[model samples]
Target: AARIIVIQKRAAGKKWGKIMVQWHPLLTTSIPVEQPKGQGIKDLWEDIRLPGEGYYFREQRFGNPGQTSMKLTERVIIAFSNPDDVILDPFLGSGTTAVACKRLNRHYIGFEISPEYCKIAKARLLAEKTLWD
Candidate 1:
């Protein structure tokens, strides 16, 4: 599946993110599974709105310029991985990937170069942990 992020700002081109599926033939058994009915996800997603500077600006305040919506991250995670699967995120901006992994019962390793974003990611993960406790 592919998600195209359309920003509302003028002159901003559409941003693209994709889930790349790879497996060694005869060695890997991973395959995409069917999502439950009425999950609102499609092969081509065009309806998920980007967080703007209005009511949805709460997520953008973390100073991660490349922040994405949690819904999008969750959908991608669900499509690509199974419960308890280990996922690796090279850029852990704001901890969206980790939070989604926690919510979906997956283990994740995330790396961020900026200390500020690292702090934000840890806080977000902690918040998610407390939610289930």
Candidate 2:
């Protein structure tokens, strides 16, 4: 069963939304089998708040303009993948996705175009790794 989750965000006086598609891929056979019973994620999520300018703001501390919520990323990772699954993140930004993947025991391949952001991501990833060690 595939599900599409829509996340709406309003920042900098502009309204934008992101769509997350979740589906189980059949790696062995073409025939689809019954998926394991589990709680379903709602199509619309409104609880997670975006990071903003505040004294306590931490998600965007790396200065990534497009940074997202860590809770939101972890929820998506938990809903769509299992332990040891490989996740590809084209735009790593501050490495939120990779950090979440590490916390969830999933492997991740992240790419960041900016050298500064890459350093930030590596630092974050290392911090996350140290927590588990």
**Local distance difference test, candidate 2:** 0.68
On the 0 to 100 scale, the lDDT of residue 65 in model 2 is: 67
Error (Å) of candidate 2 at residue 25 is: 22
For model 2, the stretches where C-alpha displacement exceeds 4 angstroms are: 1-3, 8-37, 51-60, 130-132
lDDT of 1: 0.66
Error of 1 at 97 (Å): 0.5
**What lDDT does the true structure give each of the candidates?**
0.66, 0.68
lDDT of 2 at 48: 57
Clashing pairs in 2: none
**Candidate 1 Cα misplacement greater than 4 A, ranges:** 1-31, 37-41, 51-60, 130-132
Model 2 Cα lDDT, one tens digit per residue, 104-127: 899999988999999999988887
> What are the per-residue Cα lDDT tens digits for candidate 1 across 1-133?
3343232321223445733222111122344556678364344444444443333433445777777778767867887688999989999988999999999999999999999999999988887853458
Best by TM-score: 2
